[model samples]
Target: MRVLSRFKASTIRRWLLAVGAAAVDPAGVLVCAVLLWLGTAGLCIAMLLVSREDAYHQAIQVGRNLTLVLERDIVRSVELYDLSLRAVAEGAANPSVMSLPKELRNQVLFERPTTARYLGPITVYGPDGTVQACSIETSIRRTHRPDVRWFITQAEKTDAGLYVSAPYASRTAGGKIVLALGRQITSPDGKFAGVVVGRLSIDYFRELLDGLSVGKQGGMAVIETNGILLTRLPYNRNDVGKDFSHSPVFVRFMKDGAGSFVGTATIDGVRRLYVYRHIHGLPFVVGVAPALSEVYAGWRWRASWVALLMALFTVALAAGAWSLMSELRRRQVARAQLQRMARRDALTGLENRGTFDEVSRREFLRAKRNGTPLSLLFIDIDNFKAYNDHYGHQAGDYVIKRVASRIASRVFRPGDHVARYGGEEFVVVLPETDAGSAVLIAEEIRLAIYELDIKHVKSQYGRVTISIGAASSGEPDTVDEAALIKAADMATYDAKSTGRNRVCWHTASNGLNADEHIKNTEPGDQAHP
Candidate 1:
């Protein structure tokens, strides 16, 4: 089992290494890593935004559900109270109520069996707005009618069997804010008899809202269709019956009829996600709102962790890419040094014979294709064998290096090549040069070497000198590289045979007798056919 586990681990490690090598190109690794980091960061940001939006939606949904529940609760309570008012109005309209005693009449019309806690005593008003009957003994003696807003509304709304009034201060209930539900009572002849009004304490709604699960900064409110605030959670006495017609939430609610929004509450100036619902059968709206900060608390924590991880990932990738690029650059520099060593002559620091051959062949082919003249110069050290015998091999090597340097310096031009061809011999190739120009350049090189004045007692010149044989091919396509080399070699041999330390050129007009042509032209004169 141990052996199998070790084998699997090694295989996995090797596979990972192979994948890394294939995927990471040093030149583009940094770019790819940066793009990857940006993409990841963008994805994280997108996720954070999505999460925030989802949280907002969820908060709105919670508020909407609470709003719906409150709406139903308030509507059901008002409808129940309206039924009580209808019963009182019908009873008060009966002729039997006039015959009954005042106390019994009040009992029959105002006092009824009920289970509501916040319901006030029912009051009956005459058509002239005078108190006819009251459930409370103290209110019965009062001469003036209640003079509440519901009395006017009920009188005006003859067709409406029931009417709910906006929140107002109740005189009978000691000036406490309350809501009224009233029904219009009519005579047998269809004349307006009076109104029966039932006042409900605002504390009922305030206590109901207090029992709800709104967050620490959350709130709830009930408003009439005319934009009058009826009741609010964390109830402030001044807020009751206040106008909210200009508020943004109320305006939108009125326009959309029913919807959700995010806005600052007009009551407390707290920013919240608000959900509102229009009561189905009542002239009122209910809203539940929770603070925005509480909704996004969890998302912020998760986003922080995501951002931290993305930062660490970006840093690691950048560091790896830098190290890889640095290693690749070092390897490239080492390979270039090796290539230079392979193609260059060690002593003279010029091209070796192999590199020379390759370059010359390429140049020759290019010149042939273009119909340009190409020239070759084969240079031999004068009395090099005798000089080596006298000065020893070390001195011969020094002389060879000095001569190669001089030749290279003289033929410095674009497309010109200089090489150490063999023992005691150097070669130069000049492209776009004719026989006359080639001979002129050869004389210059010969003179430059002769001027070096290296002591050579056994030589005829008494100094280190060179013998140059130059050959030019104007029609390079018809003349091959070997033919051109052979022509230059034969000219070099003739220069050596005649006298060392001189320049000679192979010319077509000379008919292979270069010596005859050399006799007519002066030492520094241009070589002609």
Candidate 2:
């Protein structure tokens, strides 16, 4: 049985892989599931095919067994007829036995062998082909009259071999069919003297076959090698002596000694699986032909159940695979949330410096490819150290948070980003912004943070304020992420060095001439300086 192939070990490993892959590549789960199902289905089909073939072969073996029993019985009957014919032929040729009284002659030649019901009386026919004597008062059927085939064959061939005639209707009583078994008697000079012939009732063939237990659509037959069907059971009177020479299966029966085949009956077109055996000493072939439907009936029942079970199993497996994939997806969601939490800065609720570093590098490469300006803003609480010492550290943290929120509110663009660059400092990245626009955005943030009016008694402005340094790079290939950050940091130093609470920008000529410096030194703010 190839049933083990229905579920392969390799596909089980793939099912495991599908569960693991849900988090990495969600589509792989569905793809692997489909493959697993296809693999299982292929295995199941292969097993079912092997099983069905096994059932067919077993049926053939069983039919052969039935043919074996049938051939033995029919061959024995033909042999008995031959013996009876030989006895009468030898008695007819003897001068002494021919001269005895009718009762004694009949007693010597036809006592037991001719008395059986299946056997008709044995009779002697002279060289002139007329019946000389018979065991019973009835003579030979004489249906063939002067040109009987058995008499002609016995006279022409001096051989002692029995001539078993093809079936013919007997004129006696009911006009039943009979086979004439003939043997020739020769004189001392080897010339034919007479012949002995015995009649074997064709009814015996059907009666014996009917006793066997073949199913209703099943049958047994004794057929001549030349395709003459002697008798059949599930007995059909019309099918007796029917010629089957045109059938392909019958042609094989003529060519081969014995074998089997599946064929359709021409008269009724009933398809059957036929198993035949050639009786060793006779011209007859015994066949057991059961309907093809009958042969496969048991196999189909088992296969239907097996197929149903396999279908239910596959459905359960698919349902299980989908359920597992769902569980993996839930874990994937949880992992993603934890990952996002890791990327955030705890104090500011903004992306941390690690995210800023990676994002700014990608934006730099994009700007280089598209030939666009990329800008960065480096902001600092100008008097944060002094303010931390003057107010308490708690107030210092409060001021830092307020300044971070104010900067975030001023910078708003879909592709722009902000992150806490380090302690008391934050950085913002603006894509597709020139140095002029970047300075304007930086000035707006500086003014917004200075307007908060948080107290700083120890600093120059004596209030909490911010200094923002702006930098721009149109040629990102020459100035990478490091160069962009350095420029912004130097610009911030320049702003605080002149006076706090201002915005300053540094750039080259086409980018803002490196010597040029722009500031957020508005008229009212200089009075504090």
Candidate 3:
């Protein structure tokens, strides 16, 4: 009976132990579940954002394709009008092609007995701006041809051939619009005969865009290089000849050489995806907008199903992870570390090239809008390859890291950045800094690196040196990250060409008209032998 009592007590102790193991703390479980839920939610949110971005890009491509097709048609139509005008001129000279317009036909066949009715409103003005033949009924009454802006400008700019003016309202014809194409006809002795003026139909463009097979509730838009919207449906029928002065897309469109955008808009009481692109070949922005819901209609059900399934899975996983707080924390740490590694350079702890590019572009735009001077420096280690060849690769890496760190430290300022662009190359962006200040900073960096005293056995001077290219611009219209980079690269090339361990400046103007080549001048550096 005593042994049986001891066995019962032992069995009671084992049962209590099992009960303690199974009775997990509710608070710990709750915390873990919350963490897991947050992590899963974050992952799903990221996926959704990426998917939306992909859709936006795809829509933009489709819009650009449509715009290009429409632009080609517009060009063809304009060319046909131009060709017809040329044919009239040729016929006047050789009596071959086709007949002139109704007005000219009436004058030539039924007019005066003295004058052989002149061809298509030929206006001959001499060097002194005197009218030799004022044949155009519209321009005949004007006393001084030189007073007109188009006439003086065209004559001053070109010596020969046809010059077509963009559509402008004819002030002489009661504000009637006309497309004027001018050809300077020269005499047999090389003197000027006259300017053969041909008229083109203005409503052709408006009619052509109206006929395009744009989707329901979709609009065809055209914008000029100067942020002027030539035409678009629904949003602005009045905008047919109006400029979008306050449109954000127009602002970015003028800046980007050729690209597309997707933005939110409402038309006809429904929201839509406004897809737009800048036509590179034409001085116009062409866009095709389709309802966002319509474009993604086919994928809507699939996306909804996926979202619902993911939500349910997330809930179940959260419930199961309720008791694993430590594991959840561990995973969070791992994810953060991975994200850091992806965005940062392993060598110098600076931003990676891709991240640098994005940051630089943003900074450049901010500077441009603020009308502040921005500068870029492209730096390269002279004889870096030789150094790697002589010393170990480890030593070469050390040099790169050291240089990057120095740059990061020296150019420490708000909106400034230093990055290792690639092997043996580094780029620095200095915001609100001019070319002079940028050159000074570059010299400091160059001298500091030379002070490193790293042996370059293969170098002519048997020492370490760096080549720097510096360029800067304050003109908001001219400055950008790419322009700065190009200027700096050119300066770097000059530094290399003249001699290493020096700072070179691109002395070109904002308009890029100056031919001032790089001037490589710095302390402790001589011209190449």
lDDT winner: 1
**Root-mean-square deviation per candidate:** 8.1, 8.7, 41.6
Give lDDT tens digits, candidate 3, residues 360-388: 78878887789788888889989888899
Tens digit of per-residue lDDT, candidate 2, span 357-462: 9988999899988989899989888878878887889898888788888888987887999889888989999999988888778777877877888878886776
TM-score, cand. 2: 0.72
Candidates sorted on lDDT, descending: 1, 2, 3
Clashing pairs in 3: 29-322
Q: What is the lDDT of candidate 2?
A: 0.78
Best by TM-score: 1
Question: Which 10 successive residues of model 1 have the least lDDT summed?
Answer: 518-527
| lDDT values for all models | 0.80, 0.78, 0.65
lDDT at position 126, candidate 3: 46
lDDT of 3 at 61: 74
Model 1: residues with Cα > 4 Å off, grouped in runs: 1-27, 96-114, 130-143, 213-219, 233-235, 267-271, 292-302, 338-349, 352-354, 379-406, 420-426, 446-467, 475-478, 489-502, 508-529
- Descending-TM-score candidate ranking: 1, 2, 3
Q: TM-score of every model?
A: 0.77, 0.72, 0.38
